[model samples]
Target: DVKVTQSSRYLVKRTGEKVFLECVQDMDHENMFWYRQDPGLGLRLIYFSYDVKMKEKGDIPEGYSVSREKKERFSLILESASTNQTSMYLCASSLLGLWATEQYFGPGTRLTVT
Candidate 1:
């Protein structure tokens, strides 16, 4: 079975502290994505990598960055945590080159920056 695992299910941090969220997929997928979900804005893509070491900035990348060192692992870094950045962060992985391929999502990490 294909599985995606997240390092944390919840996180609490003070403003200005750096945070790291990790994800790993058991499936050998080529596309990995990081997204943040807000109440009004919905799910907004933060970053993605189609291949190892090749990352693309997404819609909201101002305070976020991503690293994909291996095919199955992707990491999201919050440069400096802030109250506005508090949201549920989701990580997903999908197979490449398939029109209908569904992305396998990890249980989101709910981060609260006070």
Candidate 2:
């Protein structure tokens, strides 16, 4: 089975603090993504990389960025954490061009900005 690992299970930060979240996948999926899951908003994409060193901004890219230096690793960086940014961040990966490509998600990192 494919595995995706997140760096933190929970995090607490002050408003305006810079934060970094890491993700690693065992499967060599071509598509990688970072999303913030909010109560009502659901999973809103932050960024995704289709290939190593190549990235594209997703729907909700504000306040966040991503890095894909290797096929197995992807990182999400929050330039400045905010109170409204308190949410569960999920990392996912999928195989490109698969008709029913379902994203495999990590356990998620719940961040609370105070």
Candidate 3:
């Protein structure tokens, strides 16, 4: 079974603090993605990596960045936490070149910035 794990299930931080959210996939997938879920806006892509050491900025990458140093690991970094940035962060992985393949998701991390 494809398993995706997140470093934390919940996080709380004060404004301006740096936050790191880590994700790892057991499957040897080539595409990993980071997304933030908001009430009205729904799930918005934050960043994604198609290959190790290759990343692409998503819709809301202004306050966030990502790293994919290893094939199974992907990390999301919030440079400066803010109230508006507080949301449920999700990580997903899928096999490369297989558009129809299901993407496995990790348990989302709910972050609250005070």
User: Per-residue CA lDDT of candidate 2, range 1-114, in tens?
Assistant: 989999999999999898999999999999999999998888999999999999999998988888889998999998888898899999999988859479999999999999
Which wins on lDDT, candidate 1 or candidate 2? 1
Give one digit per residue, the lDDT tens place, for model 3 in 1-114. 889999999999999999999999998999999999999898999999999999999998998989999999999999999999989999999998856477889999999999
Supply the TM-score for candidate 1.
Answer: 0.96
- Maximum-lDDT candidate: 3
Estimate every model's Cα lDDT from 0 to 1: 0.94, 0.93, 0.94
Please write out the lDDT profile of model 1 over residues 22-79, one tens digit for every residue. Answer: 9999989999999999998889999999999999999989998888999999999998
Off by over 4 Å in 2: 98-100
lDDT for model 3: 0.94
Which wins on lDDT, candidate 2 or candidate 3?
A: 3
Candidate 3: residue 55 lDDT (0-100): 99
Candidate 3: segments with Cα more than 4 A from true spot: none
